[model samples]
Target chain A: MTTTTTTRAAAGSGSGSGKSARGVAPSGKPFVTFEQANRRLKWALLAPALGFVGLMIAFPLAFTINLSLTDAFGAVNAGSSYVGLQNFADALTDTRRFWPAVGRTVAFTLGAVVLETVLGLALAMLMRKAFRGMEIVRTILMVPLLATPVAIGILWMLILDPTNGIANHLLGFVGVPPQEFLGSVSQSLPTLMLIDVWQWTPMMTVLLLAGLTTLPEEPEEAARVDGANAWQRFVHIILPMLRTTILTALVLRGVDALKTFDLIYATKGPGGGSDFEAETLNVYAYGLTFDYQEYGLASAVLVLFTLFIVAVVVVLRRRTERSAS
Target chain B: MTQAIRPRRVLELSRRSFGVLAAASVLAACSRGPQTASPDAPLRVLAINHVWTQAISRYLPELEERIGRRVTMRMLTADQLTSSFNVKLNASATDIDVMTIRPLQDQMLFARNGWIADLTDRVEGDADYRWTDFQDAPRERSVTAGAAVSVPVVTERPALYYRKDLLEDFGGAPATLDDMLDIALELQRRSEGFFGFVGRGQRSGAVTQWSSFLYSFGGDFTVDGRSGIGSPEAIAAYQYYGRLLHDAGPPGATNMSLEQAMPIFAQGKAAMYVDADAIYSNFLDDSISTVTDTVGFAPFPAGQAGSVPHNIPSWSLAVNEFSLLRDDSWEFVRWASSPEMVARLQSEGIPGARQSVWDDPATLASFPADLAEAMRVNAANGVGHDRPEVMQVGRARDIVGRPLVSGIVGEDVASVAADADAEFNDFLVRDNRQQEF
Candidate 1:
C-alpha cells in the first residue's frame, strides 16, 4: 500500500509543474500532494477515535452477543459452553421478572423524559427573556444536575424518610398523611421518576434554552402581528421551529432514563426491593451479572435492551424528520 | 527526493523508537512475575469495614512483625466488598493476598468456584495455632463441602435486645415468644413513640434473622435438599413473625434492614430488637445510643420447640487461591486468626470466635457481661446457616423471604407459603440440573 501510494505521488508529480513552494522536493517532485496529505491527516486524526469506539463499544457489544448464546453462569472462569439461543428464549419467555422489568424500564424512561421535556420547556420559556437575577436562577437550576446521582439518591432518601423527613413534617401541617415513598413497592418507581425529573430537568432546560436563543424570531413576530395569542404563538411558531431540539432532549433523556442504575441501586439495592417492583431491565440485568453471576442471561437482556433503545430512537428520529419537513 | 527521503528517515526513526519503548515495557512487565508481591514484601489484605476488621487495623504492625513481612489493608463496606471481591476473584486477580469471607453466606459459593485456598492441612500442622480452641459452631461453619476454606475471625449469634427498664416493670424477661409479644404490646400501648418490636423486615436480609424464629418453631429452610418452608411449623413461624412485626413493629417495617432497625432500638424507640449479638457494642456505646444504660440482652424467646438463634461466623480470613504468595498469605491468615489476635479484638470490644479469647479474664472484663453471656447461651442452642446452605443462597433467600414479606403486608400466610414452596421446589430442581454437569 505504501509503495503504490509513493509511486502514484511520483507519477503525479512528474506531470505537474516544478514542485509547489510548500512541501516541495529539491528533485522537482512534491514531497506530498495536498490531496494525499489531507487524506492521510484525516485518517490519522480519526484512527484513535475509531479505535476507541471499537474497543469500548463495538467489542463489548460483540462479546455480549456471543455470550448471550451460551450458558456462561456463575464466576467468570466457571467454564461455560454454547447453548445457542437458550438464554434469549429464557429471557423472552420469562414473565415474572423480565417482562415486568421491561415494562418498568419503558414506564420509567417515557415517564421521566416526557415530564422533563415539559417542565424543561416551561423553565426554558420562563428564562428565555433576560432579567435581573437570571444568572442566580440558572445557577441554582444547575445544582441538581451537577450533584452525583448516588448522592442525590441518598439526599432524597433522607428527605423522603417516612418518620423524620421534612416532607412528612410539611405534609402534617396540611393535614396530609405521611406516605411510604421509597419503602412501598407501589410508590417506589414513581418516586424514582420524580427524582430523575428533579436531577435532569435542568439539563433539558439548558439544552432547550440554547435552542430557544438560536431560533429565528421572525416567525413568532409574524404570528404576533397576525393577533395570535401567547399560547397560539408558542404552539404553532416557537415549538414547530424547535422540533429537532425537542427530539434531541427526549432522545438524550430517554436513553439515560432507560439505563437508570445508580440512583435505584443506591436507594433500593439489588432486585429493586422485596417484590422487585422497581426492577427495570438495567437493574435486573445488573443483579443477574453481579448478584447471581448469570452472565449469559444478563448479556441476553442487555442485547435486547440495546435493541429496544435503538428502535425507540429510530422511531423518534423519524417523527422528528417528519415534523421538520 | 531529498525532502521526501528526509521525512521518510524521520518517520522510520520514530517508529523504531516507539517499537523499542513498547518492547522494553513488555519485558519489564514480564519480569515482574505475578501481581502478588514477593513473600518478603507487604501482604495485601482486603476486609469489610466492620468493627472486627477495623480492630485488625490497629494490630497491623504487630501482625507484620509476627509474620516477618509488611502488611497493608483495604477495608470496604459489606456491599462494596462482595461486589469487588466477586469481580476480582472471578477474574483470578492476584492483587489481594488475603480477604475476609462470610463463611455461611459465601463459603459454598467461593469454594465451588475455587476462589479460596483450602487451609485444613496447614491449620492442623501449625503447633501454636490450636485450631481446636475455636468454638465448634464457627469452626464447623468454616468448612464448605469438606474443605476448611477459611478460619473464623468474627463469630456472631443472634440475641434478643430489649429495654431492661421496660421489661423489669413488666415483671421479668419474656421466656416464650407469646410472653415476649404480650410484653412488647403492653409497652407499646403504655408509651408514645415507642415501637413494640423491630427486626430486619426487608426481604432476603430478613431471612437471616427470621431463621431463628423458624428454627424455634421446629422448621428449617430446607430439609434433605428440599424446601421446608411449606411445612405446618414453617407456616406457623411465618404467621407469628408477620403478626408481631405488623401489629407492633414500626411503620414501614417492611423496608427496615439491620441498619435501620438497630438505630430505632438504640434510640429507645423500640422496646425489643433481635439481631446479631456482635452489634451489642453499638447499643452499649454511649455516644451512639440513647438507652445504653437500659439495654439488656437475652437468648431469643422460645416458640413451639426451643429458642434457637443463629450461631454463624460472620467473618473469616482466607488466602486467595490465585495468590502466588500462598505461604505468605497463609501466614497473614494464621496471625490474624491467632488467639492473641482474637484477644486483642476482644479487648477492643469486638467479639471473637476463639473460645480461649472469650474465656480470658481480660476479654471478660472489657466486654459487656450480660451480652457476652447471652451470646454464649445463644451459641450453645444455635442453628447453623441462618439462611439456607445452598448454592445461590441469595436467590434461595429471596424465594422464601417473599412470603415473609407478603405475610407482613397482610397476605394470607398459607397461600404465600404454598406459592413460595412451589417456587423453591422449582429452583431446587433447576439448580440440581445445573449442577449435573
Candidate 2:
C-alpha cells in the first residue's frame, strides 16, 4: 500500500515537472520554446543509473529481508518454510544466549561510545592549539587506525599473556600481581572496549577536530574579550556549536561498537570468550550462523539488530539536526 | 517494428526465446564447470586444517589418479568447512567436492540432516577401503547411526610432558597420581619462580582436558550416554585438580590454554603440561624451546579408567552427500587411512597423526633418541578418548567446560563436580533438548 502511494507521488511529481514544458511557450514569450519531449529525454537518461542503484542495493536488501522471513537452518533447504514471525519471537525470547547478547550489545555500545566521545573530545581540544611537533603527533595518531585489527589483537594477546608477557613482568616489579587482562570474565569486555578506544579515538578526534576547525571563532573570542574564563568560554561559547559533530561521533562510534568482532574473537578463543562474558550481539549472531549453523536465528538477530541501529540513528539524527539548527 | 507482421520475429526473440537461449547456455557452462568434474575430471576436495590436508593428500595424490580423476585439495578452516559453501554446493553449484568433518559435527547432524551424502555402501564396497586396520574403538567412534560418517583422518591422545630438569630436581617425573601430587607439593615448596604444571584450565578446550582426568577417574558424563558426571569420582577429580592448582600449578593456570602453556613451556617457565603431542614441535624445536634438551614425556597419571590416554578429536575427511566425485573421494579416504601412508609421512618427520608410522625405523631415527623412546611410549597410550560429543555437542562443550573452569579457579572437588554434573544433565541435556525444539 505504501509502495503504491510512493509510486503515485513519484509519478505525479515527475509528470508535473514535465507538464511545465508541455506548452511550447507557456509565458507566450518570443524567445522561449520548452518541450515535454526534452524533459522526457532527460528522465530517460536518468532512469538507467537510478535503476542500476535500485537493483544493486535495493534488490539485495529485499532478498535478505525475504530470507530473513524464512526458517533457514544451515544446509537445510527443503525445510526453509515461511515462518514469518517465529524467528523474531525466538530472538526476543531466547533464554540462553540471545537476550543476554542484546544486553551486552547495549552495554558495549554505551560503554565504548560514551568513553570514546568524551576522550576524543578532550584529545581534539588539547591538540587543537598546535603547540609542538603537531604534524608528527598527528601522523603517529593514525597508526592505531592503520594497523590490522587481528594483528593488533594478537600483539595485545602476547603482551597481556599472563605468565611470560611483558605486561605482567612490568607489573611484577611494582609488586602488582599478574593480571589476566584478556582471560578473566571480569576484565575481558572492558579490555576489549579499551582496545576499541585505542584504535578508534583518533578517528573520533579527527572528526571533532574538523568540526572544531570549522567552528566559528567569533563567539569564543568575544566571550574571552568579555573577561569570561576558559572553562566558561568552552561551556557557553564552544560547546553549543559542537553538539552536532559530537552527536555524530557518538552515533558513528555507537554503530561500530555494536559490530565489534575481530579483536574480541581474536583475543579470546571461541566458546572460551572470557567465561562467555564477552559474547556481544554480533558475536552471538556470528556463532549462531557459523558455529552452530542456525542461520534462521542469526538472520532474526540481524533483523532485530538492524532495527535497533535504525532506532538509535533516528533518535541521534533528530538531536543532531536540532542542534545544528 | 519492421512492419512485416512476421511469425519469424516471435521465433527469434520474444523474451521467452531469449530466456530459453540464456538458460541453455548456462546449463551448458554448468555441465562443463568444475562442480561437474566427473569421476573422470579433477575433483576439488576441501580438507580442514593442514592436518586433514596432509592426511588426505597422503593417499589422494595417487589414489585419485588411479580412479580416473585428479583430486585437487583445498585447506579450509574448521569454521568454513562446517557452515558456508556446502549449501551453495547444490543450489549455487560450486566446485567443492569432498570436505572434512569431525565428531563435533559429523555424528548425527551431518548424516541425519543429510548434509553429508551416504557413502557407507560405496566406502564398504571399495576394494581399496580398509576397515580392519583401525581398532574397534576408533571405528565405533568414527561411525554415526550405524553408517560410516567419515574416514578417520587425524587421531590424537594427550600425554604429560614435563621438564626432566624440574622433575629431577624435585625427585623425578611422576609415575602415579600420588607421585604427581607429591611432586606438585614439593615443587611448590622449593621453587622460587618455578610453577609445577601447566594445563588448559581455561573455559574452552581446557575444560575438556580437565574432564579427561575426571572421566579417567571413573566419572562419566552420562550413563549410556546420558548425563552422569556428578558422581563421586568426578568430585575426587575436581578436588584433586583444585588442590593441584592451589598447591603446585602456576598462579593463574586457571585461565591458561595452549596459547599460554606452549609459550610458557617453551620459555622454561612452566614445569609440566598435559596436552596434545601435535604441540611437541613447539616445545622440542631448539630455536623456540630454551629447555629443549631438558624436556621429557611421560604417561598421564592413571585413574580408575586406567591409563587410557584421552583423545578428544582432530579432524576427519568425508565425502559430501552432495559430492559429485564419490568413487574418487572414497579412494582418497582409503589411501589416507592405510598403514603405508601413515608410515611414509612419519618418515618425513611430520608429527601430526599416523599411528603406524611411529614404528617406522626412519621416523624413530629422525627424533632425538631420548624423545624417540618417549614417542614410542606415547604412541602406545596417546590416542585420547573420543570427544564426548553426541548431538549439539557444541552446547555441551560450553556448559561442561564452564563449570570445569569454575572448578579450576576456586571450587572444591565434590561441589564443582556436582554443580557441573547437575548443570550438564539439567541445563545441557534436559533444558537444551527442549530448548533445541
Candidate 3:
C-alpha cells in the first residue's frame, strides 16, 4: 500500500518542472517536496482521531491520575487537598479487600481466558468442515454472546438456585449432591468464570474459525499423505499456524474478563456477596467510588488496575509477535 | 503543478472545517447557558421504582396542576437511583427538583455534600404539612446536623413472616426467638425440601434486617460512639441468628439477600422469613407467591432485651439544593408528604410515616388484620435506624457484617467479631475525620 502511494506521488512530482518543485509558496516560504506535503496531509487527516483520543481517553486518565494524588471525596467538584501517595499506600497495604480483589481479578481472567481458548479452538476444529446444520449450530452459539450480560446473570441465577433451580434437580438425577453455585462463598468466583466461558467461548470460536478458513489446505493435506494421525497433524501443522489468532483471542477475552463488572455485579452484587468472595478489582473500585465515596482511593486503585491491564496486553502482544516470527 | 494546487485546496478545506467546528461549539455553548426555571419546564423528580413511587405517580397530574407546571418523574432501581444521584448531584445538576432518598443510607452523605436542600423552615413552619404528625422515629431521621433536609414518605420495619398452615401444629407463630427456633427446627424435621427460616444473609444487604436481631439481643451498632458489634450481646445475637439459619435454613443461606430469601417463603419452600414489612405485598401478590392464602405476618419475636425492631424511613423525599425551581421542589415535597396524601397512600397498602395514618382504623382496613397489627406493634417498639448512621453507610455495613457472615458459615463468631470490631473502630475514626469537611 505504501509503495503504491509513493509511486503515484513520484509520477505526479516527475510530471512537474524542477522550477515548480523549488517554487515559492503563496506566503513566500521555501517550496516543499511531495513527501513533506504528504506528511502534512497525513497529520491533517489524523488530527480528528488524535483529538478524539485526547478528549476521551487521555483527559480522563490524566484527571484520574491527578485525582489519585488528592483527597477528592464526597462530591466531584468539592474542595480537596493534595494527599500525595497516601491513597496508593493505603490500597497497597490493605490486605483484606484490595489484595483479595487483585487475586480474584487475575484468577478470573487467567482461568476464563485459558478455558475459552482451548474450548473455542476445539469447537472451531469440530465445525471446520461443511456440515448438514452448520449455520443453525453457529446461530445458536451466538445467542449467549448476543444476550445482555445482566440478563444472562439473572437467568443463570434462576437456573442455579439451590432448592428451586433445575441445576440441582439435574444433579439429583445423577445422584450427585446439591451444589451452591452462586450462593456459596467459595464457588461464586469459579461459577462466574464458568459463565464467562459459556458466554465468550463462542466469540473465540468465531474468531478462530475465521483464521482457520484463511489457512492453506496444503499443509494439512501434506501431513495426511505423510502418515500423520489426526492429533499429530493438528499439533504439528494446524496449532502452530493458529498461534497468532489464539493469542489475539486471548488478549481480547482476557482484558474483557479482567474488567468484567456487569455479570459479577449483577449476580453477586456490591462487595460480591456475603464474604466478598467474587469481588474483582473493578467491583472493588466501583464500591469505593460510588458506594463508599472514597474517590481518592478509588482513583488510586483504578490507576493501578489500568497499569496492570496495559502490562498484560503488552506481554501478550510480545508473545504473539515472537510466535509469529 | 497539481501538487501545489492540492496543498492550497487542503488548507482551504481545513479552514472551512475549523470555521464550521467553531460555529457549532458556540451554538452548543449558547444552548447550555444558565438553567433558569422556565414556566414550561417540568418539575423533574428522580425516584426509585418502589410501590410508593408507583402509587404517587398516579396522582402526579394533581401535583402538576397545583404547582402550575408539567411534572416528569423518572424511576430507577435502588442501585441505579444511587448512582444517578451521585453522578448528577456531584455535577451540581439543576434538573432534579425532587429525589427519593434513603434517610438511613444516604441522608448523611447528601447532607455532608450539601446536595440536598434544607427543608427545616418548609417542614416546620408550615402547620398544614404537620411535620410533627410523622412518627417520632421516622421524623427524627429526616434531620441531619440539626436541619431537616428531607421528609419521610415510606416507613419500613421488620416483620416476622410465618407459614400459618405450617404453624397449625405448633399452635401459632412463635412469640420469642427461642420458641421460633424450636418451631423452625421442628418444621424442618418434617419436610425434605422445606426450610424453616430464610432471611437476608448477604454481608452488606443483611445489616438492615439483622439490626432488629442485634437490638433484640440488647445491643446497638455502636456503644458510646464506638463499635458495639464486639459486645457479648452482639456476638450472642449473631450466633443465635447463625444457628437459626445454619441449622434450619436451606443450603447456601449465606448468599440469601432479600431478593433471594423472600422468594423461598413466597414459593412455600420456607416456613418463616424475617424481613422489611414494606415487602409484605410480595407475600400477598398471587402472581409471585404460591402461599398467599397461608402466609401470616407477626411482629418481630422477642429476645433477651425484648422486642426491638427497626422502624426506618426506608424512602424519603428531598429537594435538590441545586434545583432551579426550589419553591416548586418544596411544594412537591410538601404536597407528597402531606398528612392527607400519607393517609391516602397508607390506605392503598403502601405504608407511610404519618402517626395519624397508623392510628386510623380506616387506613388499617386495607392491610390484613394481623399484618396491620404486627406493623403497628413493630413501629411502636421500633428503633430509628436499621443500619449504622454514617456518611459511608455501605462501608460501615461491610465492616459490621463480616462477623454475621462468619457466624452464618459456621465459623467462630466471637473471633470474627473481635477482628471486625478493631477494623470498624479504625473505619469509624477515618469516617469521623473525613466527615469534618
Candidate 4:
C-alpha cells in the first residue's frame, strides 16, 4: 500500500507540475525552461535524502565489501592489506560453522513462515465477521508483538523450563512427559520457531484481514447461491483473492525470520549454545564480527548472507507478481 | 540546464563561502575549545556492573576529591563492556580513560592491538605502589610481552557448593571427584525431582569451570604449543565430566550456563554445584536463594592429580591506550588497586589480588569461614589460567568446549575430543599465522 500510494502521488505531482509549467504564465516570460526548473527543483528536494542514504547505507556497505577483500582483523583502524577472495573461499569451505548456519537460517525461515501463513489465514477467517469484544481480542493479540524480543525470550525460558515451568506442570495433568523446549540441542530451533509463530501470526492475521475486508462480496455470494459450501467458496473465491496478501506477509515475515538474532542471542547466547544447533547465519556473522573480532571473514559471510536474502526476496516478489497477473 | 557565472562573480562567491565557513569554524572552536582533555574534564571509567564496581561507585566521591576532578563510571555487563571497548578502541576513542577488564580473556588481544596502555613504568618505577604485592599467578597475568598492561583487581577460583543437610549422613562434602560422583548419583537415586549435581553445561561458558576438572586430571589445553586434549588424561577428564553431568545433572543439562545452573542449586533442587567463588554471595542472599542456611563451601574436590582449580584475575583495571589523561588514569588505577583499598574492599567481601590482604585474617572476616578457607586453599594450588591463553580466546574456547558438550549430552567424548583436538591444532597454526598481521 505504501509503495503504490507513494508512486501515484509522485506521478500525479510530476504531471501537474509539467502541465502548469507550460500552460500557466506567472507575471511574464520565464527565465528558465520548464524542464530546467523541474530538474533543479527535483535535485534540490533530493540532495539531502540522497546524502543521508549515501552516508548511512551505501558507505557502510561499500566499506564492508572492501573489508571483506582484506585481512581487516582486530581493530578497524589497524593496517590491512588486500587478500583477494581468500576470506570468501575460507567461509564457503567452512563445514563446521558457516554451512550449518546457512542451513539453520533456511530451515528456520521456511518452517516459521509456512506455519505462520496457514495459521494466520485460519485466524483471519474466524475474525472476519466483527463480533462483541472484537476490539479487546485484537488488542490482546497484539501483546506478544508489543513485547521486546529479549523479554519474550527470557519469558519463554521460564515458561519452557524443564523442571519447574508451568508448561511441564500443565503437561503432567494430561500424562504427557516433560519436554525440553529450548534446552535440548535437537529441539532448540523448533522451539524457537513455535515462539516466532506465536508472536508473528497475529501480524499475519492483521494484514490478511485488511486484504479480506477490501474484497467484493459478489463472487462469494454467487458461489453460495450456486450450491457451493463454505469450504468450497473459501478454497475457490476467497483464497484466490487473498493470494497477494499472503505472499506479501510471507516475504515480510520470511525476511525477519531469516535475520533473527536478538531472541536467539538472548536465549542461547554466542555460537547459539553448546552444539551450535541454533546458530543461524545472522548469529554466526555476529559472533565472528564481535565475539572473535574476525572482521574480514565476518564481512565475507555477511556479503554472502545479503546476497542470499536478496535472492530470496527477488524470487518471492516475482512469485507475488505472477499471482497478481 | 547548467548556467555559468562570470569569472569575477565566481571568485567573489567562493571568497564569501570561505569566509562563512571560517567564521563557523571559529565559532565551533570557541564553543568547545580544543579537542584535548582539560583539567576539569571528568575522568571516565568504563567498568563491568559487578559487585566491585557497585561497591566502588559508592566511594567514587573520594577518588574525585583525591584526583581533584569529577569521576564518571559507566557500568555494563561483561559482554557489553567488551563490545564497547572493541568499537571505541578500534576508532582510537579517548573518552574512556580507564576500563575494567578480564586479564585472562582480553589482555593478550588488547596488548597485541596496542589498545591498552603499557604500565610497566608506573607499576614498577614507583616503589610505594607495591606492584609485586599482588599474588604471583594474578600478577603474572597482568603483564603481556613483559609489559604491564593491566592491574589485577578481583581474583577468582571455583568453589564446591554443596548442601550441608544433604551431605550430613555422607560425612561432608566429597573429598574426591569419584566420591562426589558417587554421592551425587546416590542422591539422585534416592529422590525423584532432586538433581544430584548441577554446573555449567553450555559449551563456551562451561570452559572456565571445566578447566578445574581438566587440570585435576593432569591435563592442559596445550602441551608444548600443540593440542593436548587428545591425550589420555584429557580424554579421561572429558569422559568423567560428561558422565558426571549426564548421569546426575538435570535433563537438558547442555543448555545450562552459570545463570541457569546456579538457580537449581540456589532453589535447593540440586545436591551439589560448582562455579566461581566470587558469586558465593548470591547463594547467601535470601532474596535469590533458598538454601542459604544449608549451603557449604569446599575446595574443588581431588582428581587423579589431586585438587587444582584455576586462580584468575577475573576483573582488572587498565588504562585505554588512546586516553588523553594518561597520568590521571594511572592515578585512578594506583588508588583503586592499592594495598589499603584492597584490604578495605576485601574486608567488605569483595576479593582482591593483593597477597598481603589475603594473608590478613581480618579481611576474610566478611566471608563464611569455610568459603574463605576453601578460597585460600584453592588459591594456593590453583593454575594461572582457566582457558587457553591466545589472542582469539573466544574461538579457542569454542573449540575446546565442544567435547565438554558432547560429554554432557552422553555422546562419545573420546571421538569428539579427538575431532576437537585436530580442529584445535589446525586453528592454532592458523592463529599463529594470523598473529603476524
Candidate 5:
C-alpha cells in the first residue's frame, strides 16, 4: 500500500536506452583529445565495473528472459526441451505449489516492507534526538542485520523449540501450553516475518536515520514554531519532506523482501516452510529446480515472477512520483 | 536390576550431557569435519555420518589403528554429498576417498555417468572386504557394485512404535491394516490428544511416509519406471492413508515432521507414530521418552495380504569412481566392517550393517525388550534395501504423491490417479530417465 503512494524520484529515467549505436559509433571511436581521452580512459577503467554489472545483473536478466523460454534446471546440461509459455500456464493454474508460493511471496514482501517502513521511521525519529548509550544501542540493533540469515534461522529454531526452547519456557511462566512455532503451518509464515523484522528492522532504521539526519531542520523548526505540535510537525512537515527517502528505502528493501530466500529456506527448507506455508516465489522456483527437477515449469514460474515484480515496482515508482509532485 | 548398558550413543553423550550441549550446539557442531585432500596429502575421506563424529566419537581409536595412516574425515549432510562430489567427479579428479549417502540417493546416475569407480575388482581379492555378511535385500540397491560400489551402513526406518502399556491395556497387535485404522480411530475417541497414529502429512516428506502405507497395500513406484501411481491399488491406498490422517491424526498432521511428531509421541500426546529409527534410539535414554521402557514395535501394520511397509534407506559408504583412495580406504572400511567393530556397534546399542551383529546378546539387551523383537520382525518383513528411482519418481512423488494424497482427502481418487499416471508416463522420456532405472 505505501509502495504505490511513493513516487519515483525527480531524476527522470536515468537509463540511456534512447540512443542508437550508429549515432555514437564515431564519438566512441578510438583516440580523441588527450583530456577527452583522459575522460574516456576514466570511463574505460569503469568499463570493468559496468561489464561486471552486465555479467552479474543485466546479462543474467537477459539470460533469464531467454531461460524463461526453456527449461533450465540447476545443471546447464540437464536435458530440457524448450516449451514456450506452457510453464506459465502450468504454474498459474494447474499447479498448486507454484501459485500458493506466489501468494506467499506477495504477502511476505508486503508485510516486511510495510512493517519495516513504519518501525524504521519511528526508530529514526527516536535516534535522531540521540540518548544515553545511543551508540551502543544502535550497535546492538545492527547485530541482527549482521548475522547470517541461515544462522539466524537456526538460532530461532532453538529459541522456538517446543519442549526445551526458551520461548516455550517463557510462555510456560505465564501458563500457556508449549506452542509449536515453526513446525505449525498456522505459525510458520508469521514466524518467518518475525525473523525478517528482527534481522532487517535495523537496516531500515539505519537508512531512515540517514534520511532523517539529512532533512533540513528549518522546515520542522518552522512547523514547530507554528501551532503545530510534535505529532503535527511529524505528520505534516517531517514525513512529507522525508517522503522521497522513505520511498527509496521502500523500493530497495521491498525488492529484497520479494526475493527473500535464505531465511525461509533456512527456516523451513525447499518446499517452502512445511506444507508450502513459507514458500515464496524464489523458494518455489528453487524447489522446482533442485527438489523435483521440474526445470521447464520453474522457468515459467520465474518468468511470471519477474513480471509480477516489475509490475509492483512500476506501480510503486509511479505512485512515489505522484506523491512527490 | 542388572546395570543398564545404555545403547551405544554415537556421541557417548548421556541424556544429561545432551542437556548441556542442547539442540543448538548439537546441530551447529554437528557439521564437524573435512579437510580438503590434495594429492601427496593425507587421504581425504568425506564421511556423511555424524560428520565424522561417529568416527571421531564412536570409532576413532580403532579407525586410527586400522588405517595406519592419518586419514582425514569430513562430515556433511546427504544433500551436501550430492552438491559437492557429484560435480568434482564430473569435472576433474576429486580427492574424496569414501562418501556415505542413503542408498536411494546413491543414484546410479553417479556410476552410470562414470562418476563412481567400478568396484568389481576391489571386492574380490581384498582380504578385508567381505560382502557376504550384508542383508540380501539391499542387493538391488548396490547395483553400482557390479562388484561392490557401496557398503550398507544401517537400516534407517520408522517402525510402528505403539504404547505397549496402552496395547496391553487394550489387547493384541491389530491383526490387519484396517484393524490398525480402527484402533487409531478408537484411540482418538478417548479425547486424548494421543492419536493411535502419527505421521507427516505436510505433503513434503509426508508424501514419502504416505508412500510407505501405499507399499503395504502393495503399491509400487515403478512399472518399468513409467510409474504405477495410477494403479487401482494405489488409489485405494492413498484414500486409506488420507482418511487415517484426516480422522485419526492430530489437527496439524499435515505439517508434522520427525521433529514435531516425536515430541507429541514422547509426551503421551501421541500414542502411535511411524518414523525413522533414529528417534527410537534418542527416545530410549528415558530423559526424552518416559515411556521408553513400555514402547512396543511391530512391522507397520500390514494390508489384507499382509504386505510389509517400505521406508527410505539409511546411507552407506560408496567410493566415487573419481576417488583415488579405494585401495587405502578399503583397509579402514574392512576394519570397520569386521565382526569386532560390529560388536562394538552392538555394545553401543546401535545396529550395524552386519546381520551377525544382530545375533549378539549384548546388542539385543541394550534396547527395550519389545524393540529387539520388532527389529528382527521388521528386518524380516520390512524393505531395508534401496529401490532404484525409476523414471520421474522424484517428480511423481511431488506431483502425484502429494497431490494424490491431498485430493483423496479433499476431492476424488480416480481422477487424481489418472492425472498422476498421465503426468508420470509423460516424464518417462529417455533424457528425463537420468540413469536411475
Candidate 6:
C-alpha cells in the first residue's frame, strides 16, 4: 500500500512537472523513472489495441476512399482506371434512388432511436423499485434481445403475412379490417422501425436501469424535504444525473440503427420492397455493391454515410460534454 | 521447501513438453497435401435448390459410379446461387467444381466475364454425348456468342395454370388476353374471397413473367437494339396487365414473388396463375396442394400476336473456369447431361431438356399428357430470351419492372413506360461504353 501510494504520487508529479526523473522507491533503491516508465507502460498497453483497431477500421476506410475514385466494377479482378470524383458526383446527383434512400435512413434511425429511448426510460423508472417477480420480468424483457435479428425478421414475416398471418386473424376477431403490414409501401418502413424498437427497447431499459441504480438518494431526499413532487424530482434531479448515460445509449443505438441491414435484407430483400419504399442508404449501398456490382459508386455512398454518422456522433458528444459541465 | 522445489521443476518440465507437442502437430499439419482434387478425389458440385437438382443429388450414388469418384453437392436458392457464384467466380475460387446456371439471366453476362468455361470442344469430342439430342430452344439458350458455355438441364416455359373446374364453369379457358381478363373479372364478381389471378409482382423478378404478356401483345423491350418499351404495343400491354391485376388479384400482390404466388393458386384462392412450368409439380403433389386434380395447364393466351411464351433453359450445369480439376468437372457435367441420366430423371417426374426423354414411352406415361402437349407447343413457338440479353440484365429488369409495378398499382402507364424506356436506353449506352473499354 505504501509503495502504491508513493508510485501514484510520483507518477502524478512527473505528469504535472513534465519531467523525466527517477522516482525513489520506499526502499530507497534506484528504481525506474516514473515519467519514462509511465510513458512506456502507456504505449505498451495501447499499441496492440490501436494496431488492431487500425487494421479493422482504418484499412477498410482507406480502401473505400481509394476505390471511390476508380471505375472498378463487374468482375472482381477487372482492371479499373482512376476516374477522380466522377463517382461522387454521380451519387450526389442521383435523385432517383440515392436521395430518397438518405431520407428513409434518417427517418428510420430517428424513429427507432427516439421510440426506444422514451419507452426505455419509462420502463426503467417503473422498475427502479424492487418488487415481486422482478427477476422473472427482467428475464422476460431479455427474450427479444436473445433472438437473432434474422430470426426476428422471419418470425415477424409469418405473423404479419396478409392472408394467413395471425395478426390479421386477431384483427378479424375485433372486426378490424385486414391490413397489409410489411406489404404496403407506406406502412413497410414504419413497421420495420416498430420491429427495431421492440427488439432494442429492452437494451436501453437495462442501460438506464444501471444508471438509475447509481443515482444518489440524498438528492431526492433533499428535494422531497423541500416539498418537491415526484415529477419535479425526476425531471430536475434524476434526468440531469442521467444525461451522460442517455447520450451513451443514443450513440450506441444510433450507429446501429443507421447501418441496419440484416433485418431489412432478411425481410424485404435487396431493393427493400417492390417500389424501393423501404430502401435506406445502407441497403442502397449494399445493392450497388453486391446486386449491381457498382463498386466505385457503392464506395462513394459508404464514405458519405460514414461521414454523416461521425458528424452526428460528434454533435451528440459535444452536447453531452456541455451538459456534464 | 521440498513441495515448492518440486512444483517449479514440474512447471519447467510441462512447458518443454508442451513445446515439443506443438512442434509435432505443426509438422504433421505441414506434411498434408494441398486441397486440390485428383481424379480419385470427391467432386464438389454446387446446384440451385430445385426439383431437378434435388433429383441429381438423390442419385449421387449412380453418378459416383459413372464418374468413378465420390460426389458432394451443395444446394442454394437461385438468388443465393447467383450472388455467391458472382463472388466466388470473381475471386477465381476453385472450391466449387460444377455449378448451376440460368442461361437467360446469367449466360451472356457470365460468359462475357469469362467466369464459365466453354464446353464446345468437349461436346464435339464426346461421341456418346449426342449434343444434338437436346431440344433446339434449350440448346440455343445455353449458347452465347457462338460458344457453348453450359449444358441445359431443366427447360421451362411460362404457361397459364388455371382451375379446370372454375374454367369449365367460366366457358372453358380463355383463348385471348381480353377473354382471360373478362373471365377473371366475372368469376371474381361471382365469388367472395376468391381472387381471379396471381403471378409474380416483385420488381426485377416479375420481368420474366411479364415478358410473355409483352410478347403476346406484339411488344418487345428492345427492337433493333433500341428501347421499344414506349411503343404503342408495349403501352397497351402494360395498361392491360394493370387493369387485370388491379381488378382481380389478391391483396398485397405487389409483394408476391413466384414462391409466394404459387401457394395462393395451389390453395384454390386464385383461379389462374401464369408462371414457369417448372412449378407444375408443386400444384400436382397432393401432399402440399389442395387443387392437384383440378389444375390444368394451357399455352399462354394470345393477344395481337399468336400465343408467345418464354421457352428458356431455367437451369443448366456449367464448369468453373478456375477449377483445378477441369477434366473431372467436365466428366461430372457430361454424366449429368447424358441420355440415360436425363431419361432416368424424366421417368422420376423431373423435367429434362433432351428431346429423347420428351419422346420416351415411359416418360410420356409418367408425365401429365396435357401439360406435356402444352410444353411442346409453347417450346415450338417460344422466344429464345425471356428478358433482354445484356450484361446489365438485373438493372435492365429493374428499369422495366418499376413501370410494371406502378401500372399494377394504378399509376399512369404511359409516363411510367416512357421513364423506363429512357433509363433502359441510358443503361444500354453505358454498358456499350464499358464493353468498348
| Steric overlap count per candidate | 0, 12, 0, 0, 15, 0
lDDT of 2 by residue, A103-175 (tens): 7788877888888888888989999897789988989998999998889998888888766679888988899
Interface RMSD of 4: 8.9
lDDT of 3 by residue, B1-437 (tens): 54434454444444467668756875795475867878799999999999999999999999888878998999999999999999999888888999999999999899999999999988889888788899898889999889999999999999999999999888899999989999888788423678889888889888899999999999998998899999999999999988888889888788888888989999999899999988999988999999989999999999999999999999999999999999999989888988899889999999999988888899988889999999999988999998988878999999999999888888999999999999898888988886775
Clashes of 4: 0
Docking class of 2: incorrect
Window of ten residues with lowest summed lDDT in model 5 chain A: A5-14
Query: In model 5, how well does chain A match by TM-score?
Result: 0.81
Model 5, B1-437: lDDT tens per residue? 01111111132334475455554554676453453443455656777655223733456555665556567777776556665764455344557776675556544555554555555566556655556666666645765535466666655554777777767756756656788788888887423245767676655556656656667787766666566778877788878877776677765455556666677677665567777554576556678777666677666677854646553346666766655566666665666556676667656666666667776677678666666666676667766432326423345455556554464245576787788678667766643546442
When candidate 5 is compared with the true two-chain complex, its DockQ is 0.09
